[model samples]
Target: MQQNKNDLQTTNKTKDSERIPAIRMFNLEDESSAFEIGSIPILMPTDATSFWASNKTEDWEQKMHPAPRKQYVVTIKGKLKFTVSDGSTFILEPGIILLAEDTIGEGHSWEIIDGNEWIRLYIPLSADADDHFIAENIG
Candidate 1:
């Protein structure tokens, strides 16, 4: 049997890295549109529901739930400003990624900074049915 070099490299990197494994089953760039932006599911845990959030900002504002799962946001264009309940604000720029664990407390809101584009990937605490199965229907 023949093995590909890139595959071997990826395997080696996975084994060497101490961080969470990277799953690239979905692409955000394909979902962009001029109006009515939307999101898609990328990597879903076996016992949880995971999906992506993509939208365009044009002086639009909204409040968001803390969510029962973890969240990872990556800005593709413009800027995004998040104001937490504690009165601290966070700004996300292009090519930057932000991760919010499920353990974090609630009270968070988001807004577009000067009509920017925002894309977010959500990972649930439990696994999805396709990813894996929990014992005794715990999920």
Candidate 2:
């Protein structure tokens, strides 16, 4: 019975480890950018230029465009379907963490879906720092 219990524990651990979400990072250098899965724990905010929360509902079939700056876009409620310039598409649901790095050239576009209102928090990345380094260090 003890051996069976140990086996079950191991199986559960394996399943949990496999369930990590792949974060999508829109990159300026490579529109063919791939998703990054890092080991970073939830980080406490250190320094930020500014942050804001808004509830919006837009008719969002926007053309492919880069973000004005590097930022962290968290979907607090509602969902959006995002298609990066490289042809990768992801559904941005509530609780999704999007590291928006495609600040130049063709970036990404989105269509608002799900609900009449979407709430989000936006935090711009530091001018002196880059997303990859921050992600690596935090993890």
Off by over 4 Å in 1: 1-53, 56-61, 102-105, 123-139
In candidate 2, list every pair of residues with a backbone clash: none
lDDT of 2 by residue, 84-127 (tens): 76787878776556777667667778777887667889888787
**Top lDDT prediction, candidate number:** 2
The alpha-carbon lDDT assigned to residue 82 of candidate 1 equals 64
What would the per-residue lDDT of candidate 1 be over residues 69-121, giving only the tens digit for each residue?
Answer: 44445555666666655445656566444444323344356677776356555
The candidate 2 region of ten consecutive residues with least summed lDDT is: 130-139
Query: Any runs in candidate 2 off by more than 4 Å, and if so which?
Result: 1-22, 28-40, 57-61, 130-139
Best by TM-score: 2
User: In model 1, what is the error at residue 85, expressed in angstroms?
Assistant: 1.6
lDDT of each: 0.44, 0.64
